[model samples]
Target: MSEVMGQQKNNLELNDNFEDHDSVSDSQVVDYLFAHPDFFVKHAHLFEELDIPHAHKGSVSLVELQSEQLRKKVRLLNYKLNQLISIARQNEQIYRVYADLNLRLLATQSMEEMQLVLEEVMQERLQLESVVIKPFIGAYAFPEIQRRLFVEKRFRRDKFFFGRLSEHERKLLFPQQEANSVALLLLGELGELGMLAVSSKDPSHFNPDMDTLLITQLQQFLSILLPKLMKY
Candidate 1:
């Protein structure tokens, strides 16, 4: 009887101890660690023992995981910075070309002079194989098939079209020349005047994916210049 009573007493003591230990919650431990910042410094070995969940695979040490995350962020930032720099350099080059063309256009005294200068500059500086400024009347006079292929399909409403051209379209725009791709910019307001067609032998030279800000600006500039030139 006395042995049974002693066993029960021991069980009660163990339950009390467990209850006391359970009173210290996980938040309390985190709070205690925050209170003592030097705790990790005092126990440097804990760094090796600490395991953090990783994005892939099993686990990694806390320090190792943090370092990896920082490296990834740095790589992402570097890639973005490089893209911005590349875009800026490209914009600078485009601006220089546009400025040169604008100066030449402004210097011309007549429509013939402007056309000659425009064609020569585009071929020499811009690497275009063929450049033509077709008047609306000329475009209207095109054969039914040619008009439907280029005018009706491409410039029905859009001010600009850039991409590979069909063989017939290429031949129509650039007769006696081999052109694999073309960019057509509507010359006047709602294309009342006509269009400017620039072509290249390289298939990828003009595509819909290309940035058209520079081309759009050039179109607007020509719109202002062509009206005055036509009056001359």
Candidate 2:
């Protein structure tokens, strides 16, 4: 139902004939949202888990979730055979971006390349229209949670108070000048972070009314994938 999710469904839908292919259905996504509101709500513990959804819960484990619930959610998110194909296609895009940037990164040898990879991830993985990943001004050298405050503050300000502030409020709080850009942070080998943010020349992209699920999924994606990708 969220734009990103909608695009995800659309991207997956573009794959092939639905007559035989099992596919992701919009109804299933809606059903989960209606049934499992708390299950989908964002939590910090998610950041600690690394097992990919379909992979066996290996030694590098994620929190044991309600297995059936997770299965349904994954199934719903993934849809059917064609959707799985779409998911594969999407990953290929991610790898291509990663491969190209990895080569560039090796030559450039700049830590900033990681963030650049994130910029590419936004386009490739998440499929947003425009993206900019400004490093947190003091975040680089700060302690782990210190940088988090900015994200938290931004979320809380948008959430607890407004609960759904209009688009105007988002711009004032997360403006480019503050360097409060939403980015997927990489500590490399240690872990990664995913951020949800929008942009606008029209000024409505950050509007308070926007759905928070966008942010929630970024964190969720990191929760499931970051630790698994870490080197042993």
Candidate 3:
């Protein structure tokens, strides 16, 4: 009977000790989990059991949230891959078109024929608004004053110019056609031959930093061809 009484008293003392202490706070639970990095490895079942608040689904397990994130990343990667493929195809097509134009220019007989070919290929195939070759001399020469102004304003340093043109400049270069942006290529090695201007209706189509690979080839070919055509 005395042993039973002593055991009862010990149980009461244990209960009283527990009541004297405060309950564990949320911060204490978080601190304990942070202190033990391998806690998830030990309690792996919590990956599926723990509920995470979801804006769209009300609640989702941690495993479901991770899966959704992976799916979104995969979709974004696929979208970027598709964009790169589309740009590559476009570049290939542009290269082929420029190649065909270069071949056609070599076969051209007269200045008029050359201009016609440029207009047809550029306007019809390349979808440019206008293409013009303004010579410094010959029967189809551009006015000297306007030519000088253009050269001073646009070709002070660079052989190629690309950007929006002023209203007056647009009228001189592409009088009959609508032009928001233009790319200008100086024709001769010494810039004595003339200027070749290609215009687009879209304002952002041409810019200063565009690559001149195809256009540079075209300009070099024209510089050789124009002198021969002008003599005849």
User: Which candidate tops lDDT?
Assistant: 3
For residues 125-180, write the lDDT of model 2, one tens digit per residue.
55543353323323334344644654455444332111222344344335442222
Tell me the tens digit of each residue's lDDT in model 3 across 1-232: 9999999999999999789657867898799989998998999988978999999999999889989999999999999999999999999999999999999999999999999999999999999999999998888888999988889999999888999889999989888998999999888988889999999999988998888899999999999999999983
**TM per candidate:** 0.65, 0.28, 0.83
The lowest-lDDT stretch of 10 consecutive residues in candidate 1 is: 138-147
The 10-residue segment with the lowest total lDDT in model 3: 20-29
> What lDDT would candidate 2 get against the real structure?
0.45
**TM-score of candidate 2 relative to the true fold:** 0.28
Candidate 1 lDDT tens digits, 100-160: 8888888777767977887887888877898877765442334555545676788776889
User: Of the candidates numbered 1 and 3, which has the greater lDDT value?
Assistant: 3
Model 1 error, position 208 (Å): 3.2
lDDT of each: 0.81, 0.45, 0.92
| Order by lDDT, highest first | 3, 1, 2
Worst 10 residues of 2 by lDDT: 157-166
